[model samples]
Target: MNEENNLEQPQETLGQALKKRREETGMSLEQLAGALKLSVLQLQRLENDEHELLGPATFVKGYIKSYCRELKIDSQAMLELLPEHVEPAKKSKMQSFSRRTEKEANDSRLMLFSYFILAVIIGSSVFWWWQNSNQNIEEPVTTVMPNQLESSDISPDLAVAAPAEETIIQPEADVPTTSNETQSQVAAQPQTEKADPEHSEVVMHFNEDSWVEIHDGNGDRIAFGVKKAGYIMKVTGPQPFNVVLGKHQVVDITFQGETIDTSHFAKNRLAKFTLPLTE
Candidate 1:
């Protein structure tokens, strides 16, 4: 009888037994709570033997049985530690769950706030870059002059004019005005034939029956001639000429007739002439 009573000595406290079982299973308070479908704080309180309220013996027994089963413990032996009430444990678990849920909600709010701040910083940076790029765009430069340009500078006049009054007024009193007077007289003179001493004379040589033509720098024909070997002509003027002999035969020439020698006459042969110009 004494041995039976010693074996049934109302085991250790619920907290002590729970702690021993957790240690044996290598589980933490949180791990045990997860296995028992209880909150961490509630499991902590139960392990600490802080049972202030009591309820039905049957409920407590069931709870103890379930906890022992998860730890692979002897259920009957573990149940000897549980109180006859379980209302306090249930309420404690509810409070612990509520606290954990609140903490999670707070953490989520903080994360969202951090993301919002990051978005604002990135958006501001992009806007600043865009604005700076627009400001950096180069504009074309324009040049300005103090004085406006004249029409004469753009397009010159082609008419000839008499000398200005300033030209007629001589700077040296001793120098004869006869030179200027003579120029005036010459300008007033009528346009009639008076030989100009300064004129060019040219000579032409014909090697065969040829046609000689005179042309200015602009290629306009000034004079032309068709001649046999002994035919010669004299012209008195400043003129450049082109001589054509048969097809694809050509030469450039200039002439101001001073003299000619057409004496030796021949046909289908060659002859030469001389020309001179006064400086």
Candidate 2:
């Protein structure tokens, strides 16, 4: 009976086990989370094994590792249970990312189609104007026959051959402008500083409290501190940014107005990404 009871002892979950160990050491969740340098929600999710709430799902292992470190738990013992919590999330993330890629491909196709149609319209307009302008140009008037001139010359005043009226062909100020010329002028216009396509900037907005470290690819630190919820940060530097976030679920990152998808790193619950994959 004793052997059976020992064998049947209920096992504690990852969260419960971690919580138990923390309490044994006289530590609070907030304090533990703070010690881990992450948000309380992140610690809660880790304790509860709320895999669904963990962003990028891939970072679960990373966050778990950090949490285990904070509690001074045996990493190998806890990590054996990690696969069970991590696999389902990996599958879900794959499906979601695939769908997003499909949508982006469709949007790109639509934009290309629109540009093609616009080019055809402009080309046709230019061709039509060229044909019409050539047709409208006045041809030189042939000299009147001498016989015909003499037949109509009954009046001496009319025979004076009125000082060959000058034919000044001044270009009309109100002449219709061709689309081709307009397009050429627009293409030649210089772009402003803000309008440069390659202009680089990194911006991050936090949804909740999180710790952040901003650095360059070469490891030079730029900014490091705990940022509060709704905190907005913009960075521009001599190097590409390597950003590390304490928690990523509520954080937003952008490069020149484009939203960056960092879901792949969400599993760590902490997020690390480079603004440009290459400097």
Candidate 3:
């Protein structure tokens, strides 16, 4: 019956007792907090008995002892009445959970951004392909049959199109079909000619612009011509032929395809150059 009566009585919490003591000493929260060199929130939490919010048991006990000393209360008495401090394990778990949730949110945002960028790239590629295909489809057809153009009634702009001129294949009569050896064989055919076996002849090869004359020993004119550069002329006559040259340096004479040395007469520009046709 006595214990029940004790339980029924109004019990003062550790915070309420400290608040009463502080007020009796004529100390406000700010004054008490300033004298204790503590924050107003810290003092308020201590007075309100929010020991769990203030952190670990040792720290809360220290703050309470400081408050009691500042308010001139019993520090040991207030500490004995305070509740147990919360466990650090629970706080650690809460922090881990908060970090995990934040990390998950950031990962989700990154995945969504990646998906958005991928979708844009795919959409752009598909749009470009579609546009390119449409351009290919809309392009004009330029090739037509030659017979169709000749038989059908054509537009004036298209009628001016000469299919015969554009598509007609010319006959390859003079066109060389074989290799370059065939061309060399064809070029050698005209320069081949037989000379008389009895009386030997002289051949003059012209390499520049020069007036020349060639006559036999019988005073018969065999050849007389004005030759330009790269002109190959054959003036064949009897032995001891008289060969006149306007420019002696520009002419090259040969007997039986052998070069005749005309360097002895190199000083005289105009002279009768002799030809030893036999040897």
Candidate 4:
């Protein structure tokens, strides 16, 4: 009886045992492959026990463990069927090594891209700042005279008038007058009008005769005059008025139309006012 029972005990290769269990369950090789999420070729290699096609012992052991569980076979019995010298595939080792290499390569590419973007931003910002700084630099200023018919208009004759070092003359006595006299004259003499001490003086000198017009801040024409080289006129204003001289000359003066001789006064007689007329 003991000899017969020993002969009845199952003894088979790993591949044969797996094949027997699969056939007993009426499962095709394709069905088993699908259930294991493996390709048909992979399952066929395992069923045939092809050592050359098998990757590593670890992969073989994992497959055996999973297949045994799914087929209701004992995992210990399946493991016992494998030869001691045959090793299963090590899938995790290869996958971990590949993943590390791929991650390093991706990190290097990202670092290079970051550096490139930073350099472009810094270079562009520096170029823009340089251009802006150059634009802010001021240019040399040149003076020009107007073509209006007023003593206030700076002309070519006035350009060559007095030397810069000449001392100005303040005549106390009145000069002789011509035939054109009016009610605006002081003491019936046109030249006897004295400068008001309370008002500030704004003298304008010209080379030739030119027309002068005065306007307020609201564009209202306050006064007009035709003046010669040494002609002097005065206007009363609480603040500086907009004095438009000739066709080009424009200035703001408190009391305008007073003239000075080029021989006695400074050559560049045009004064720079506080407010800039041109932008």
Candidate 5:
């Protein structure tokens, strides 16, 4: 009965047994800590059975096992004496792996989202560039000055004539009058015209510096230039000439001796119309 009672008594904890075994091997705390690659504070905690201070239940179990290995003691026997509340090392490793996997999954989703945003930005940039390129191709503008005008733009039959000298005729007054009356009579007399009314095909009188381009029925550019103010130009081309004028407010056009009303066709200070303009 006494022997059975003694056998039923409580055994020392895993930490206490490890410490006793280490002392029997004549190894100091520093020497054991160095061999096990553990700090002296950690080794002291383990020897003192400070399970809470040592860290998690899993870490305490690992320290206990390492202590048994260095002391050359049986680890299985000592491990059985651990508290039931302590978790197993396998369970701890599995929990760590699960958390790492969750973190990696979140990172993967973030990366995919970043790629989606980048793709949208690139697509928008390319679309904007494409739209601008098409706009440039569709509407084209040409600028030409009189001095830089090419000979090819003018037809050979369309010769530019110089302005003729004016021959003023003084009307004879039947009776001598005041000087103001004489001046009024001279002002009433008309100045000579630069263009021939009966023979001219197309005539342009510029009130300011203006840009003009004319294409004939056969698509030939008969005359195009930036004409100076008070300048008169005559051009002979096929019927139904295509004309574009920049600053139409500063020009007058007469086709085949009939005045052209360009106010209806003017837009944003420019005019585009066909000669012999249809109603």
Candidate 6:
């Protein structure tokens, strides 16, 4: 019976209680605002009972609680002084705004997913069409007439003529040569044998641009520079040659008439090796 009577009695509002406590503590609004890390205008609005100007009922309740704590009073009892309908009216607009923002984000994600699916479908269709077109183009258009088929099925024992054996006349072992031919042969023999025995050829066929540097056993720089694509370079140098290549995959190196497989020796797209690779 006493609890009901106490509930029926009019109670001091939260703002009025907070203002009375602040005055009892001998603290100005500015001093309290600085202590609570709040602006003086917000403190004034809180003390003056301006809940509408404080943004939200939740924030207003928080400010009241902080003010109660600073004054060393019961924050829960102070919070209970707020009207029951205050939060419902004030928070409705915030809840609606939050819901609207969430809806917009969801819509954007759905739209992006729809575009991705559409692009995938379009790409798949194009690929399928291309495959079909290629198959259609590759198929041969061939037809066989009945008369041609009958002609092709001739009797095997009707004495079909065998193709005439080619006749190849064999040359005599000893053929007399003219004076000019004998002299030309004699001159060509020395020219062929005149190749330098001290030098070996290092050939590089470049399919892409690559920088190459080469040094022979004699410490002579035989080749150095950036070789362009499709350029075939041949350097004749002494054996046990030192070679360096920028972008080893771009160039095919052939030493002593054999292509070297230096791709495995490459590191960071560069290769360094010696010609006539030792065991």
Q: Candidate 3 on 224-273: residue-level lDDT in tens?
A: 54455676666544566777665567778787567887666654355466
RMSD of 1: 20.3
Each candidate: what lDDT? 0.50, 0.64, 0.67, 0.56, 0.69, 0.70
Model 3 scores a C-alpha lDDT of: 0.67
Candidate 4 lDDT:
0.56
lDDT, residue 120, candidate 3? 100
TM-score result, candidate 1: 0.26
lDDT of 4 at 64: 80
Better model by lDDT: candidate 1 vs candidate 2: 2
Model 6, residue 193: distance off in Å is 6.9
Please provide TM-scores, in order, for all candidate models, with all chains considered together. Answer: 0.26, 0.34, 0.43, 0.39, 0.36, 0.31
**Cα RMSD for candidate 6?**
23.9
The alpha-carbon lDDT assigned to residue 54 of candidate 2 equals 77
**Model 1 Cα lDDT, one tens digit per residue, 1-279:** 999999989767877987887897799877777878877766665667655532345555666677778888888877666655545667778989999999999999999999999999999999999998887664322212212121222111110111111111111213345688876765664232123322233454444334444443334444343333444433334333332222112222334423333334242223222223222
Model 2 over residues 1-279: C-alpha lDDT tens digits? 999998899877777777778789998988877787888998888778786677654677788788778778887787676535444657677989999999999999999999999999999999999988877664332223221112122133322322222121111223235778875665565344224433345688888755566775455665655555677877645346677666666688887667887766645355667776532
Model 4 residue 213 distance off true place after TM-score fit, in angstroms: 14
- Best to worst by lDDT, what's the order? 6, 5, 3, 2, 4, 1
In model 4, state the lDDT of residue 150.
Answer: 26
